[model samples]
Target: MPRPRGHPRSLRARPELQRLEPKVLLTTFTLTSPTRGALLPAGVSPVGGIVIDLIGEGGSRVVSQIRARDLFVGDFEGGNPPESRGNPGTIGERPGFSPAVVDALGGALAELSVRLTVDDGDTGPGDFDRDDNTLLLNGIAVGRFDRVPTVETDASGTAILSENPEGGFRNDRVDTGFFHVTDPEVLRLVLDSIRDTGAIVVQLLDDDPGDNFFDFTVGIDAALIDVDLPPEPQNRSPRITSLRVEEPVVEGRPSRVIVSASDPDADDAITFRFALEGDGRIEPSETPGEAWLTVPRDGTVRLSVRVEDDRGAFDEAGRAVVVRNAAPSVTVAADQDAIEGREAILAIGSFDDPGLEDGWSVAVDWGDGSAVETFPVDRPGPIPPRPHRYLQDGDYSVTVRVSDGADASEASALVRVRNAPPALQQVLAPRRVTLGTPVDLAAAVSDPGILDPLTVSIDWGAGEPSRIDLPPGSTAFESAFLYDRIGSFVITVTVSDDRQESAVLGVPVTVEAPEPVPPAQAADQALAEALLPADPADPRPATLAIAPDGPGRPAPAPSPSPATLAAPIATLVGQDAPDPAPRASSPPPIPVEAPSAVVSAEQTAPAAPPPPTESAGVAAGSAEAPDAAAVGPEAIASASPSPAVVDPGPDPDPDATMAPETATVAPAVGAADAAEAASSTAVAAGDDDPGAETRSGAMRATVLIVAALTVRRGGSRIRQSLRSASVRSARS
Candidate 1:
């Protein structure tokens, strides 16, 4: 035989005689002894060819009948058996084969089929004619014209082999119809048949059950599917419930904006971020619920409030707020003119705002250095005027400042004050008067704005003045100046109010010396004197006296006889002498001489009693006769008689009778004689002469006559006698 293409050379060289020899190829065998079985030998090559060899006496010469149905050929090893271990080929047995060989043969056939398929060609009864006897080399049928061989079992249980000189196995003879009988019953029958055809003996060892094979031609189809997802949660918008501003809309100040929302799933509260319409900067607020933003002095600002939820959803709300540029207005006025040292009240007016409840105030500056006062208007009412007093005196600018809630305004006034001159009034009376005379001075003035008049004083240019009430309509006054000294003096009078004084007014007064002492008797002088004393030598008399001379007798003969004369002239000069003499002698007894020639009756009549003399004598008649009888010639001669022939002086009657001359003479003589006798006796006793006595007596008679004549000439000798007796008694 030639090797095929790409075959090895070791499989190509063999002798023709070896190829033609009948090699007792055990194609089929049956066992009559012990049991039916099959043999699997090495180096057998076929798809499905069963080879048998006889052995063991109990494995009798059993006539094994091989049927075509009992033999299989192909690559039996490629077929899986029904059991988990492996699939064994079936071998049919004749009835004469023992049960043991039947079982052994069945296993041997399966083994030989597996070995033959791996090594030789398939040789079985079914692979050739059934009635013909055949011989084979190995399991291949011998032929010259390509004829298949057939085999038969003799009674001795020998296999008769025959070859057919005909075309048999094809060149491409593949047993494509090889089927593995996994049915246990069918597989047992095939084993029985192999046991009976026991030319080759088989021993029943452990079965190699085949792996369980499943034809999983059916599959499941899988794909990834997608369904639509729920729509994403939408962002919720924030709500603005209320908006409020904390402060009044001052143009440039920061204000607060508050926003609210109703997001249950909110992670952050709403915040308001603000921006002015014209500004460039954006300010962020820190407050979560409310935000305060500074407003600019411009247009309205846009406020955006944003709130964010936990699901990363955000929402925003917006609003606009306006900012104004103008501030509040203020005006001020005063209730009175601005005067120095006087109160001025100020009234304030201002704009109103509800946000700023405590509104405006007023301050008054009185142009003096003083503190300012402030007022607050928290409610609706009139603002009390602020009063200020300026201490200085001059033109002053009084400033009043009124304030709004935010700012202030000012106004001023000019206050003029003229200096108040002191009020002056002069008080005086009798503008002119004699010096040293009293005059009244008074004044009437009024300071209506100052204290009372008692507080004022007067200065009369003299000293402090005494207070006085002013008379009606009198402004100037006069007071006494006893200007005893002669000169001119200016009287200056001034009136004073406490704050100021009046100008001095000079009143010139010329004081003259008083008129010389007026005559004392003058009307005015009398008055003056009444007030003074009287003069000493006022030679004026108050009374006067007169005297007359004696009566008759031709002034009584300037010269009389010395006897007739009275006493000596010295005696006549004496303060004691009686002015008139007394008649001491009795009346003459003589009658008046008759007209006829008769002797004078006086010569013839008796004489009166005589005045007693120092000598004792009684004159009786006639001036010469001491007594008629005694009338001697000598006595008569001795007596100084008057010259005779005398007429009777102033006798109213001449016829008066004459007394008897004789009787008158007798008594006188007797008286003389007695005196003589007594004297004689005294002489005898040593007495002086009686005749001398008589003559002495006669002288005594004449002395008596003279004394009587003196008495008669003088008046009243009785007064002289009484004056003499009173002197004698006083002396005694």
Candidate 2:
């Protein structure tokens, strides 16, 4: 059998060609000729045949052809005469046939066929012609034809070749059926033979010998062949067009999954299936290609959906979903006390599912008719505190809410707002502090609400108060100051919370001055007191006139002789010194002088007492002596009582009381002597002469006055004796 003409040679490498399955290559040919007016044998106007050539890349060739004599068989100028032209019979209808020679070589052959034609001129040589053809395979006779067209003859009895008066051949179209080796084993041998030998040949031949004598003109209009190639299996796995699942899968909660699939082969039937390998359960839904699922507690859920075609072609798609717990729990806290115009802090906390605690967001409400605030939380534990300030005093509440977009929770707390003025709890200070002394002062200051920052200060009377700032929530404060001046001072302590409110407290302190000392005197105090009597009738009158050197009094005039000097009359024995001196016979006694200035009365009682001195004899008469006995009755009657002398009390033993003046000279004699001097001196002068008597009394009083001054200068013992003597004298 002939191979198909114009088969494409293999363009692949040897290894690629081996990979290709063996199959017959099909081709078709339309035959035509450019040689039109060639000389022909008698009774044969024109004849033609067609041959096809196939060339391979490896320098191989294959050929196939259509025979001309197989169609239009006739004999005219030769021995046989032509029969009627119009009637022809069919060829390929019979069933019985002998196998060709090439059928033994696996009988893989390409087929060939031809159509015969005849035409007349314009005068009409042949007007009607039927298409009749013979088919050939590998040069073997395969088909016989009988249909043909006939031409009318003119009076000359000649067949027309053209209908045109100008003379031209007929033009028409015809078809040849396809033929080729289709058996797998036969096609494989054929392809192998061609590949090995590098070539194969096909030819066409006229099977009727008598028809060949007419040299019938044959034309191959077309040739076609079938190949051993069937369509590719066309079995394609189904493709997963789309896969989807409901988002945010939660533990122990049902989720939905949707899957879609398609196959390239439209006629293929497909079935869908689903699987969940871990952390979840999956089941097919009532609808096709859909499923329902529940995830396990925490972790990933792996899901796979598969689609299978009727031809066993299949495809699958997989997905992973992470499951989490429920909504988060939130809590908020803040300081209970809040002060107006002060800042307060509120803290937040949240707890989420065990493995899913990371991402979150928070919103807060200050509960004071203000907008809510929101922020994202990057950390999982306690959140940083948020700060807020209140402008007015009132009670306020706070809230904090947390969310993970899908779930949320919240917590709340309360904050108390108050305009608590600064308070001074206690001032630790001293009452009596000395000038120039640094006193430690401390004040316990506090705010009952808000615990806002406070300032504590102390005004230390002398200057501006020193101040110290306290941080929020502080209580006690202290400082020190030195008072520069001394007096009653008021200390003020002021405490402020820096929030337009403050408090103050005050304290008192006192100071004093020193005392002065008195000067000492040298006069005798006891004698002087006796001279200046309290009673009007007493000797005070005489004493004031006669006693020249009494307390706060001036000294008497000095005389030439000591005995006549009244100023020295205090030198009298047994009396304070300054007693009158006695007169002498021959020589005048040395003059006695008086002190320059009057002594202070307080100096009479000196700090220390003087030693006792022996008694000195008083003058009985002197140049200036006067006689008290001669005084007139009027002078005597008018005389006040002598100074009340401090009398020494008589001793229980008479002898002691009568003891000599020398024995009592220490203190007792002074008192007694002062008393008697007034009278004794008077008596010793004249008792009959009134003028002399008055003069004597006056002199005596002067001596007593000086003696009293000396007694006062002595100690407490001497003073007691004076008192005793004064009492006795008064009694006497």
Candidate 3:
């Protein structure tokens, strides 16, 4: 399509294009796709894939060729190749974005700005810069797989858009999420053009580049249909529409102040600036109509906003915001279901009194016996939610509490934790199996729900699938399989529980025709097989079963106290302990007193978790330990600078009897202090390695052991062992 050098409007009207009467033709004008930017008129570039005066309503061109100047809209000089592959190359197929504004723009609303954000199945409804290897709405290069309503660029830097997207990602049409288009030039065309012609003629194109049509696909989805457009436009001084202040603005907390203004000019772009005229503060955006206001103390503050258009004309508006020292507010969005052993998410929104700079603290009771997590915050922002993984399948009520020194707020969310899929612990399948000779296949699987029934389905990749049902609570199974076909096949095994959740394992196998075994070799193999250990009557593997300690369930006693743990220590390290005769007179289990959580004076807390199941192994409660993951090195290092705590009571007997397995152990004094100090050193030294987190847990156990051993060695040895344990913990 060639056009003369001087004309901006390459579209000329054909009277026949007018299907409606001259009086009422404008419904709404919108562009659903973006176009390539080649062969556009001289001074025009579809910067955001927009063109003027080209309209397509109901999928047909409203105007014919603009041949009034002796040149018609024609096909590109070269387009399709000899091998078409049956895909018709469009005429004059050029990467020329010819999205025409609805002729309603001649008198419609004047200004708009189109902003886009990436939805990578994570944080979005925000803003983003065009990343390199732009996968602009999946138009050109084939990119990585992203969820629908997402914008992702491939790692190889190609945004893939093919004619046939089978078994791959294809989201050609989508909701132009939260559209707010405000390009003044486009509005002017639509608003005034309709006034001039009484009918809006338009075309919306998302198409190919010139001569390159043979390779590239047709278009990319970019909807301007979502843009808000008014029917009429008038030239008048823009007035402030609204100035709102979000209420309950707490001191040291940030609150939202929304401002709006309207311009009736055909092509005016308004720029707004804001100022806090009182004790409050605000970081004004150059062209922002809304801002966050923060004040140091509780009081009233005045906010003034000024709006100036492209012209020198301007208008001013003011609003009052009340800041108070109120309890922090919290709102957590109900997130998707959490898989067992995976982090459960809580989407917490922020509520600022005015946008204060003070810090706060939060506490979370996981409703599991694991431990309560506490985080001390130092900034006046939304406190981060602690991460916790449930160990079993059940409902758990997670509670979140926040304190800002003087005031506190709490919330809760009901979380349903589904069973974790069975794990493929071990598999035994030969790479090459003799055809028709009984080939043995064995797979070991374990489920977190020890009582749940399990099944294993095997697909030999020979179009046959075989399933084996294991005994209830069984964790392993072995079977003999016979392959009749002689070819390479993938032995795929899928292990699923009643929950429909499953785990799969695949191994390659080649079944070959059997070869005759030598008589001596066959006898030797038979003797060897006869000597091999017979398959166990029960195939279940011996492994430690994880017990779920739900809320309200008191912890079972073990060592009792560090003062009398010498005997129990031997049993813990694998030495057997003498079994005691059953006694109904056993003392009640000691209360499991957990650590304390400290809250700061300036924080806002997020939402809480769900309630707990009745038969939990460990009750979820606030058990705050300032680990390096939540808090940083400085915080961890200073967490517990106090010396190792030793009870001043008379020393207990060194040969004190150990408590029964059901007996509870009291927490050791200064153990948290030692663990925190050790963590800080590890973090500062950057000892990040594979399984560092897992090792940290073991280190804590070792700390408790050392603390137990020190009780019998007297006070002097206590300090020495504490230092030794702290030093050794860094490498853990």
Q: Estimate each model's TM-score.
A: 0.23, 0.32, 0.22
Which candidate number would show the highest TM-score if scored against the true structure? 2
Regarding TM-score, does 1 or 3 come out ahead? 1
Cα-based RMSD of candidate 1: 51.5
Question: Given candidate 1, what's the lDDT at residue 693?
Answer: 37
Summarize candidate 1's per-residue lDDT along 596-708 as a digit string, tens digits: 01111113211222222222212232222122221111100011111121222222111111111111011111122222322332233224333433333332232222222
lDDT of 2 by residue, 396-484 (tens): 77788887666788888788887868678898788876666677887777676444677777777777679888887777887987766
The numbered model that scores best in lDDT is: 2
lDDT of 3: 0.39
Relative to the unseen true structure, what is the C-alpha lDDT of residue 280 in candidate 3, on a scale of 0 to 100? 63
Q: For all the candidates, what are their Cα RMSDs to the real structure?
A: 51.5, 24.0, 53.4
Q: What is the lDDT of residue 79 in candidate 1?
A: 34
Regions of candidate 2 where Cα sits further than 4 Å from its true position:
1-256, 261-273, 283-287, 292-301, 306-426, 433-454, 459-490, 500-505, 513-732
